[model samples]
Target: MAPNSSAPHTPERPGTPVIPGFAHRRVEVAEGVALHAAVGGAGRPIVLLHGFPQTHLMWRHVAADLAADHTVICPDLRGYGASDKPAATGPAVYAKRTMAADVVALARALGHERFALAGHDRGALVAFRAGLDHPGAISHLACLDVLPTPDMWDVLHGRDAAVGFHLYLMAQPPGLPERLIAADADAFFGHFLDLWAEDPAAVPPAVRAAYLEACRNAVPSIVADYRASATVDADDDLADRAAGNRLRMPVTVLQQDWGAALGYDAAGLWRAWAPDLRHATVDCGHFMAEEAPGRVAAELRWLLAR
Candidate 1:
């Protein structure tokens, strides 16, 4: 279920420290739920959506530079950072549809009728869905280290699916994985923070600890999100494919070149989905924003220019 915009913004979960030039705000989109957002810079808003485990802080280095020329808005995706985590609604609200609504609403709340977008990991999924679902509202899009939700599952089926064991495990009977993850929050959440990071040391100790704690705190909502992917999300993508609607806006994609293992035609796949597409692989891990902020910023600049 969606939250009420009239509800107070209460502190629910821990958040990464707001860096310099960035000011954090809590905005109510629905009746009772408010999203925690960080804003900085000026002109032509460029919103940053973070991946799993990490909050908007993941875009700190990148957002800092973009802040100079672009109004940077970074939000803790619903249920992840300080955002509302109401009782998980039906599979639809947790669906990327709902998540994208949170982003669209967040931008509108911040006076952004149009903006550029960049998302990392789970945020990337949200960005893709938002770009598709609200094509007219977004001007430019950049996705880091992810494929479309349906393509992700379709390509990963059977033998290739083992890479994302979390998906399989999260898809299992809910209470089990949710409880297991919640039980040893630090260990469960920190495992990915350690593994997925190309440079584990890039994230400070305090930051890593904070991210693990947030993941631990939001396990139920997070699991609910992944569970939706197996149900409603799968169906949504099928409908989209059946409709043959591709992104009409300019898109820039950055990935780890998992093409070798995933057997995905990265550029070709994006070309099929986006009308104007620029796709490339980086010599980095899944966490491109954190590992290579300079290169990522450079690519983003190039993408925006195009």
Candidate 2:
């Protein structure tokens, strides 16, 4: 399945914290992959997944705010932040399925067998797969600015092709996008970071600098993530479709109504995979998590209470 044409986006979660925690740190999740996990507060767990061109730092505001009430575990997905980027044997390594596993493993390491999840942009894709595969662990699901794997792919392959050029380019053999992207890292990745944002002024200078620096440094891993989506992810969706499994948790998706332009009720499409679903159109652009942190936080609390 193809990703939506929406610009890729991540952090700066919410208000001040109560318990005074959160010193930047790292942990070795796998042989070489040192996942960056920010742990704060104590209670039932809420694991956050950050979007592209950013990292766990994207959840800084939201995670810190949430940490006051519940244990918040925000990790830089494998190959994203200070996380180790391993050499890939194939697409499976960078596939969302694998990324989902990283989240699952990270949660287990943090002593959470059951937890709630919320993801943004690329992080949402990883969270979607995690919910489907590990239904028992993810009790509540929230996705920001994305569709399910199959529906997204279906939309991308047809009339809205131009909107998702990154899918085709990133899907290419390694070295191409990495080389080109690494050249003008800021302008390349920053284009989406700047464009998809509804309020550019909302993104503070420090936050903006952190995002650009991370994307520029992790071009190969980032490209591998998209590449795996094109190859292994395509096969994964086809396999899941053949098996006919749907998410078995209450699901909330807030996104731009690309459905109007792409031709389909986006919420209706989501119902095919999520039995319990609620969909809404947000006024902001692709980076809903960053643009509307308070609204996003309210929605997460809404899902949590549900």
Candidate 3:
């Protein structure tokens, strides 16, 4: 299905507007799946995908800065924010392959056959899949604060694995995880915002509230998305590895030195998957885009230049 071209290019939700100078619209990427995207500027197109527990609003600062010289497109990934949260028919539904397809179709709907792609956290997983699956569609790729699913699983062993407890929690068969999170959604979701941020104040009150609300309302879909990561997503990554498939485009990764903490060579692991790779460790916490937008934007520019 083509994007709803008739959909007004304005913020779909009245209470929470997108970044200033940007317009919001819902683009139908697949049947029964439409993504809410905030678009601005005009040059080479760059799609920004937000991480977990946050909406496209997380890109407010970075998007605004990039908008000056590039068409900045920020979309809340499927099952996130205002996007359609279809009930999971199977684990494959929320696989990164499906999510990546949603992004490719979204860019094409906006008249961009090939564009730069960047994703933070969960969105980074989708961007990784896009680079591997749709290399011809994504001209460049940048992933913020995440490793590939296979690498991620390989590195988790002791205390380091516990740090990602949420991964194991959501990876469970689903019903219990959904129930537990639903019981106290705000606190559960807010824990990451508080724990993973270098500066909690980096996320404004209004923006934080928006994230909480989005997560609270989409508990089931969110859990299902994570569950897919453990099963189908992991399988896809392993299959690619077995086939000796690597990302074809120039890839840049910005992560918060998980290797230093977990005692693994994060860069080396990434190098195996991306032959043309630029991996750097950032000083900020998980939410690097929020804590260090300037640095994130600089890295993105470098990726695009490469």
Candidate 4:
């Protein structure tokens, strides 16, 4: 199917307007799904994936800066922002495997058979899968503020799990999670924008509104995406580990000191999966791309240089 130009537009979230000098287009990456991507600049391709509750607009600061020398492609993952949100068939439908394939297809469709890839939050999980499953296709991988599905599950036990209450809630068997979230979508989704950010002002009012609206519209798909992580996604990660599969590409992980909170070696866990790894803690919160784009962009450049 061609890009649906007639899709209903959220009044508050027009598009990625914060990032100047970029053209927005929806490219069909799968049989029924198409990703809404912002393409900008020209050079080596670098695809950036945004986290939850935010769209490609989260890459506004970093993408523009990287666009000077690198072709920055920021896409709203399936079920988020302006991208196609298909009904959740099962855990497999929203598995990171499926989402990772979308990224590969999106890049190839845009003439980048191989490219540098970076993702934040939920996007990071997809990128991790991309690096592991399609090593030949990703030259370098950068993940911000996330762990592999298995590692994530390993660390969440008691009080630490409280921090990720949303995860447990969304991982439930569907119906209730969607209904509860839809009841007060703005308040539910907007809470994360405020709670997860060290500096709440990092995400400006307009951008925050855009994120909230996007999440409100994408509640079911977003929940399905998370629910997959707890079930099918975790199983995939464990299977890969049992098979001794690791990401061979150069990898850089920028995260907060979640290790201290979770009582596990965050860097060590990532090091086990990525042989060529550079893991470090950032001072900012989970939304590092928006909270500290300069630092995030610098790290991405470093990953490319490696």
| Candidate number of the best TM-score | 3
Candidate 3 accuracy as lDDT: 0.91
Give the winner by lDDT: 1 or 4: 4
lDDT of 2 at 79: 76
- In each prediction, how many residue pairs overlap at the backbone (N, C-alpha, C within less than 3 A)? 8, 7, 0, 0
Q: Give the TM-score of candidate 4.
A: 0.95
Ten residues in sequence with the least summed lDDT for candidate 4: 3-12
Question: How high is the CA lDDT of each candidate model?
Answer: 0.82, 0.78, 0.91, 0.89
Ranking by lDDT: 3, 4, 1, 2
Q: What is candidate 2's lDDT per residue for 1-306, written digit by digit as tens?
A: 111111111122343221237654455555555566777877778998999877777776777678778888887888786566877777888889988887887787667889999999889989989998899999999998887766777787665787888777888898878888888999988888887888886667777777787777788889999888777877887788789988899998988878887887888887887888888888887877777777888888888888
Off by over 4 Å in 1: 1-16
What RMSD, rounded to one decimal, does every model reach? 2.6, 6.7, 1.3, 2.5
lDDT of candidate 1?
0.82
Ranked by TM-score, the better of candidates 1 and 4 is: 4
Question: How do the residues 1-306 of candidate 1 rate in per-residue lDDT, one tens digit apiece?
Answer: 354232223334445456577877787766666788888899888889999878888898999999889999888888888887877756776788888888888888778888888898889988988998998888899999988877788678677777799988888766898888888888877878888888987788867876776787799988988887888877887788799988888899999988887776877777778879888889877778888999999998888887
Output the number of the lDDT-best candidate. 3
The TM-scores, one per candidate, come to 0.93, 0.90, 0.97, 0.95
**Between the candidate structures 1 and 3, which one is better when assessed by TM-score?**
3
**Per-residue lDDT of candidate 3, residues 99-164 (tens digit):** 999999989888899999999999999999999999999899999999899889888988768899
